[model samples]
Target chain A: MTFRQSPTRWALADGRELLFFTLPGHDCEPVPDRRSLPQRCAAQSELRFDRTTGQWVIIAALRQDRTYMPPADRCPLCPGPSGLTSEIPAADYDVVAFENRFASLTEAGGSAFQLPDPADADFVSAPSHGRCEVICFSSDHTGSFAGLDFRQARLVVEAWRHRTAELSATPGIEQVFCFENRGAEIGVTLTHPHGQIYGYPYLTPRTEQMLQAARAHRTRTGTNLFADVLAHEVRDGARIVARTELFTAFVPFAARWPVEVHIYPNRFAHNLLDLDGAELDEFTRVYSDILQRLDRLYPTPLPYMAALHQYADTDAQREGYFHVEVMSTRRSATKLKYLASSESAMDAFINDVRPEAIAEMVRTA
Target chain B: MTFRQSPTRWALADGRELLFFTLPGHDCEPVPDRRSLPQRCAAQSELRFDRTTGQWVIIAALRQDRTYMPPADRCPLCPGPSGLTSEIPAADYDVVAFENRFASLTEAGGSAFQLPDPADADFVSAPSHGRCEVICFSSDHTGSFAGLDFRQARLVVEAWRHRTAELSATPGIEQVFCFENRGAEIGVTLTHPHGQIYGYPYLTPRTEQMLQAARAHRTRTGTNLFADVLAHEVRDGARIVARTELFTAFVPFAARWPVEVHIYPNRFAHNLLDLDGAELDEFTRVYSDILQRLDRLYPTPLPYMAALHQYADTDAQREGYFHVEVMSTRRSATKLKYLASSESAMDAFINDVRPEAIAEMVRTA
Candidate 1:
């Protein structure tokens, strides 16, 4: 029942071919001593693996949540004095970013465990030393990132750049991921218009897979993998939803989701800190176009889970290209794309819509 | 630009990987043709592949709707005499299980594709033969399965067994998956106390992966893979949440999720039909215990995703054992676990808590 102290491997039910990156001891022991529960829970924080196409998912157990739609009188993110939280100069903010009070990833040191097998009796700390931050998309608590103007989005992007640089400077910060969760449907506890930043201690599985693919591609083709992809999608225009000099928002031909989208830089950049002023405009405009289109697609605002990816700062194997991934649950106004047994267990997707069709519907004003 | 008529695979960001799935080629055309929105939406659907994980995802542009959540009052699964709907039997049902009107998998035949691949955009449907049945867990629409009484829950399980057996008898039906999705947090459209049953057309990844592992194990070790694992878990008591002759539930060492539990039958049973009479009491008690513990752990009911694993009806792969998987959200009542960049892009997990601590907490009951 000894779980791997680090990312390692485990035997599947067959017990022959070892599943790679298995944090072993999580299921080492049985809880009741009888072997298992009728409906017991797995003591897993996350399961990092590579999909055939190269996506990553952290199956962390303790996912961080926040309070959403709070009263105006209770301002948590704002500065102090009359404000319950820290306050700032009373002025219109264009996508202002800030540090989060509570983060799953933090500079604060804590014991993250490599859980014992449900059969085992001991636990080991999973070595995850990282930092977490929050990016305020706007000072106004009501509107969402989509509702904000392009300028506002750009400022937000700048804040991301600054934070990336700051976190990268941290000794243990390996990867910096920026993301947002909107709407109560997806368990967004806080209604404050904000996004999150997580500086990982090591490379996440998806990034590792991508890096492996990139390295493999580079070996075979002698070219940057993402650069070729960007060029191909831009020239092809088959799945391109929106485009600008800096960024191109498109629904990938092989969409893992029904309403999946990627807003990547046409020219490859490793992190937010790398984008210049002119590049920033392109990023902002394309993102704004996608957001606006997303809003118009549904009468009511949609709930979405999105992230900004970057290379790990302290990992041994770190080859990541920065990109913004926007996954909206709004496959339809009401029908969500739940990852059922087949999808979650087998890692397959049963998308109900074509990426091209959805791309065309991307409400580009 | 021409997409597959059925499932197809395409290259991803990296050339090394491929994305695969069936997405009807609704609006696609020859490399040169770029039709407007309506024209494209009218094309046949096609499937796409994910290169990273070699999984398939579909895109039916025709079914694409801006909105996904249907109005609660408009029950789509069961239509009554009110409009163009059919009603269930007038008899009182503790938990009703019925075939879905608009099923994703139908008995209707399609162009047959090969076994599987995400890169080979070569998926042709094979009579898309499968059944989708809904299990009404409770008469009370607002109450979730957690709120069900022992009798009601047992009835739901019975309904699942009946439906699984009935649906699995179909010629091509390989797997019978019975699952309940509650709470809008997990993107359940209908708030009604109902679950879903999918009699799959082909062997899902779970069965396939395990079958491969088992075959490899038999080739190497000359023994049952699950047999030794079960014995080992029985020997150790730490990770066992609960156990019974009919089912032994434990947290596996390599748990990818926070609170993931697996319920395995002491006997080698591939589906729910294998359960006898008295075995269900233990099942009911333990299941209830697990739910009670989970609900108690969190002041309110926690949001979790789970699946009842069944075997792939493939002749050689029937040796696989069925299990129930429960991955509770790693979120506390106040915060949510965001599957951001590192998680969504990478297949990795980082836990904030240890399983031993969690198991200790769960073991209290």
Candidate 2:
């Protein structure tokens, strides 16, 4: 697949790369970042290992100062006038991607995060190393991904695919995650219809669990776990929300969230990079449909997290299954599902809505 | 450990068991539940297993209608007058424990939950058979646990131990969790000084991970994971917030929450039931102190979840280690730490505070 326009790359004043993705034949004019900015953040972040569960926790103390609920006019994600500088240098662009200023992980720090000392193995510490990028879906600040036209949505998908493929090739990035946090109810600081990409230094905890489960399933049944699950959901049909030629959207039988939907491509793929032109089109269409349906369930736009799960550098592509989990905290029109004791502390989930019932709602809506 | 007064048990109007726990040698008055109540919840909840992760999720659809922040005068946790019948029958009490009216899991149902059928292995589901109970820490409507006197705290500990032991013995109860969600910020619907006991039908996801890590540690290092973690924290000293003769409170090396403290007894105990008289006393003292320190860190009482994790029925006593994880979402004086895409979706936590700094603040506070 060829894009209408190649991505134009530029650097911000703080030495962070910014890329503008435009449609074929559209021109992105060069605009320099003139605002005086620091070369790097004053605070440093690191990762620590928890011996009990063997999970890494990020400590980015500087992130406490991240912009919260900025005014729309001053939104850093939006295009600005000559005197007003934002993260993006372009006055207007189709879709833009830029490195986060207050990033939890950074590539400029070092070659890789330093491993924990062997003497104090229990108190393991490592320098936080990776990359974090913000992807603006549209130049219009008030627009959402669901509200984007087919061409705009397709462009965003292409940009995600391009980034996933490119970031996966980065020196020490083990996993790449593309996700969106929508609605202020879910603590989204910005309302500029954007998502983020985190090229993690290590495989995420949830991804590790998924790989383990898939390996176990392969050992037991000698088949792909994702393929089997998709087949089962397709055959069962009750929890299937929507389906296209190449993708199937279904609510998992044991959904942890109140409003949860997982979309799986019919054909197996390690990540977005593996998808061809047809698959990308199908994904964009089904994903947009799911988002619209979620919004229709309530009078207002649903507050949700659209998390894309894919393989890491270490894992074989066949062993990992790429899926999109769209989970909303809204339990009802006026209520939200909070991660309290059972969920936040114990990782056990007590959901108030059944998957089959939610599937029905999604189908009707 | 011998209590000053044995628990006095009575049946509520709904046929749920209610126990009154008082200081030693305190006489209890007999109060009967005269109000009409439903024998069981109007809605039935079920447990479904996700084939992908092999985790059980509870589906309690009727919980959407559960009580929100009710008025102080209509508080179900507070003691009621003769005409205004609350969940508790007594006019006033030191501490009381009773089954939840709108329980997510229940024992009133049939035997154990029915096992999933082989035919529908992918979408397996069962009745959510377990118990849910509320433990009132104080009779005052607006009281807080941190403000409770030492005697009251001791009674609450005893009540927790009592419930843990009894719930562990119940059929099909894999794990017992005692927790309290304080403040509206953490989604606590009730402001009453109370905690909850959840007799989970399956071992929680976090406990399973801990147990797996412990077993792995035993295999690889020939030692206990929890014991070694605690000893390492003690030896490190920097992260230790407070320590007594028998217990220690410290921020974990990989603390996930902005404000998190884990209290561990110097000695090993599988669950609350294993604690002797001295250990119980020490636990009460340290737990109360940590709670107070957390409250003092902020100008107002901090919104937090105090979770007591204990052994599962399937695991050997020695293989499990009981600990208390007190986590608060407060990142600063005004801003709350939100678990957006990373933490909620990928189970990767990015904390904005250093454990050592928090520990120093905790120690000084």
The TM-score that candidate 2 achieves is 0.96
TM-score of chain B of 2: 0.95
Model 2, B1-365: lDDT tens digits are 36864589988887888999988767556477778775676346988887777788888886877888888888888776462468887778889999888889886334755556433666688777888999999888876888888888989999998888788877788778999999899899988889999988777889888888788889888988899989989998999999888999999988999999999889888888778888998898899889888999989889999999788535443578789999999999898988899999999999999888899999999
Predicted candidate 2 versus true structure: per-residue lDDT over A92-201, tens digit per residue: 88998889999998873356454464336666777788889999999998979999999999999989987887788887788899999999888888999999999888
What value does the lDDT take at residue B285 in candidate 1?
A: 66
- List, residue by residue over A1-365, the lDDT tens digit for candidate 1: 12233222222121111111212223221111111112212233333322111222333344333344567756554322321133222223334343343445543233442322222322223333466556667657788888877655765666666667766666756666778877776656677787777776666656665676677666767876676666766887877887765678878766776667788887667776677767777777777777767778777877777877776433333345667778775677656666655566655456676677777777352
Tens digit of per-residue lDDT, candidate 1, span B215-333:
66567568766665666666777778887756787776555555666777788776666766666666666776776676667666766666877664456766577667777755555
**DockQ of every candidate:** 0.22, 0.85
Most accurate candidate by DockQ: 2
Please report, as a value between 0 and 1, the fraction of native contacts recovered by candidate 2.
0.90
lDDT of each model, Cα atoms only? 0.56, 0.85
The 10-residue segment of model 2 chain B with minimum total lDDT is B108-117
Model 2 bad stretches (over 4 Å): A1-5, A81-84, A108-120, A312-317, B108-120, B312-317
